[model samples]
Target: MSATTYDRLVEIVTKLHDAPEDRISPDVTFAQLDVDSLTMVEISMRIERELDVHIDDNELEADLTLDATTKLIDAKLAA
Candidate 1:
């Protein structure tokens, strides 16, 4: 796993979530944090801009966890 990638994601998520970094974990999902669909879209946009990756809404909605999303990013990068 890329710690830098994970850390960057956590940074972005924490900022968007308006919560502390410590509150986020690899296993925690966005729904668990009370992040609505709209915010999830915003987060997806931010992630694409910041990470220079293409993540569709469906893929994001499918797995809103740090671990799973990071894996998705890795898979995208691999592709």
Candidate 2:
């Protein structure tokens, strides 16, 4: 949606992958980033801490792309 969300997702993805921000994209999958289950959990925890939001397991499982994850986070923030 917003560039801010996209930027944040890129930042998080970059942090997780240790890649340049430009390398991360909305279409990229978590698996493609070489992120494992434990890493995903860690990412979730970081997101919760940074964004002040709670993400359910189901939601985490369902969001497969960076864009989707950003959307989910946006929706939760809206709620």
What are the TM-scores, per candidate, against the unseen true structure? 0.85, 0.80
- Give the least accurate 10-residue stretch of model 1, judged by summed lDDT: 14-23
Put down candidate 1 lDDT per residue, 1-79, tens digits, no spaces: 6557778888778777776656688898887777788878888898899988998878887346888888888788788
- For residue 28, what is the lDDT in candidate 1? 84
Q: List ranges where model 1 is wrong by over 4 Å.
A: 1-3
RMSD of each: 2.5, 2.9
Instruction: Give, for candidate 2, the lowest lDDT window spanning 10 residues.
Output: 14-23
- Please list the residue runs of candidate 2 whose C-alpha ends up more than 4 Å from where it truly belongs after superposition: 1-3, 20-22
Candidate 2 lDDT over residue span 1-79, tens digit each? 5458767767765676575555567887777767778778877877788778888766675238888898889998899
Q: Model 2 residue 76 lDDT?
A: 88
